[model samples]
Target: MARSRSRSFITTEKPTTYDEDQFALPNLNSNWVYYKGAWLVHIILIICVKILLSSVPGVSSETSWTLTNLSYMLGSFVMFHWVKGVPFDFNSGAYDGLTLWEQIDNGAQFTPAKKYLTALPIGLFLLSTHYTHYDAITFLVNFTFLAVVIIAKLPQLHKVRLFGINRLEVE
Candidate 1:
């Protein structure tokens, strides 16, 4: 007679619990460092683009410079607010897991004074750009600064440095 085999129904894997402590507050210093670095990089890019636009053979230098500065000012304003809104990956005591838009939608409020204070740097930078003469040395300095900023902000490299992870890893 042939022998019969038995089938098994139990599994070996175990479920794991989520650890709340794993989500610590992000380093505020690191956040500021990233924010400042990104801002500098953006400014350098704007300056370089302005230089290129001014150098175009057929374009009027005055008009080009004016347009570039105007655009840069507007971009600075927008970027400043946008970056301010990005949530740091680690819980930062403030708000976690909420974008700026989400905060606005949820009725998180800001005062007029607060808004003006945030925009102050942008206004100052616009004035500086308008008043400064764009020479070759100035262009070179801006480009060099921008290049340094880019290196500092490189995703892989930055993760290893003080900034720890500037962005949240979803999933």
Candidate 2:
């Protein structure tokens, strides 16, 4: 069978809308982002990346920090925005179509965790820009990455698939 492409501008995910679960067990997929020490671990990981990159002989401090920022940005964007569905089957596929960002906090908007995740990239961009000594080129590069990630996290864009980019083809 041929898979038809979704040429639509925005694909709404209403078909997979939320269903009340009687079990009420935690969703293992997204709950971890709000778990204790999650923030600390995130910061520690960034520090480790900075340290590791700095140890590279050819890598300057600015480059290392920029690379660190890029690494975190890329990873977080994919983890939060790009990738959908749960890795574990514990939730019985309730979260199978939602990205981690949408799955977090039961899809609430402007929650503390959401706010922190939003602020994190901006903080990294500011730090990278400052450390790069306000270099024009690096600033733009960092800003672009930050913008793309931030836009995808916006409440208005929830479950939105622009240009059907990530829509399930069979649907």
Candidate 3:
């Protein structure tokens, strides 16, 4: 009688920590540094838009408004995605020092509240843009909305939980 052989599958390697802070600002390879660089790029784009709007004379109001709103929307989208991979502790300094898995877990914990907070500003911005035809007002509203999104994601502020039964560390 031939006996069936049972194959054993076992691994003994410990999971690696996802600490990116080593590559951060001081190191220039961290996700936080990358986020800041991306933010600066967005700022430069906004400045270019402002300059173009002022220097060029025959650009239609519709065209200018479209460009401005597009910039804001693009910036917000970039921020939203960039934040997903960043390991930031709102309670700590600019650098969270937490592993990627820890940061992701923390973010997930507050994602529900964050989603609601994020949507409110976006909805208000859309409504304001739809009703306002003044170039200046539109610019102000668009800029303000973009700023709000950026501010809300800052490590110092991102951990805030709104209308939640469980309080975040920062709360």
Give the winner by TM-score.
2
Which regions of candidate 3 are displaced past 4 Å? 1-55, 82-84, 87-105, 108-128, 131-171
Clash pairs for candidate 2:
none
TM-score for predicted model 1 compared with the true structure? 0.35
Where does candidate 1 have its weakest 10-residue lDDT segment?
10-19
lDDT of candidates 1 onward, in order: 0.40, 0.80, 0.45
Clash number for each model: 0, 0, 1
lDDT accuracy of residue 154 in candidate 3:
47
TM-score of each: 0.35, 0.89, 0.32
Better of 2 and 3 by lDDT: 2
Score candidate 3 by lDDT: 0.45
Candidate 2 lDDT (Cα, 0 to 1)? 0.80
lDDT of 1 by residue, 46-120 (tens): 678778887888866545655565565445434332243334444332333222322331222343323433344
By how many angstroms RMSD does model 2 differ from the true structure? Answer: 2.5
- Give lDDT tens digits, candidate 2, residues 1-171: 434566677776665434565136688888888789998887899999999999989988778987888899899988998888788678777766678898888888999989998998888778777767747887777788889999998999987888878664442
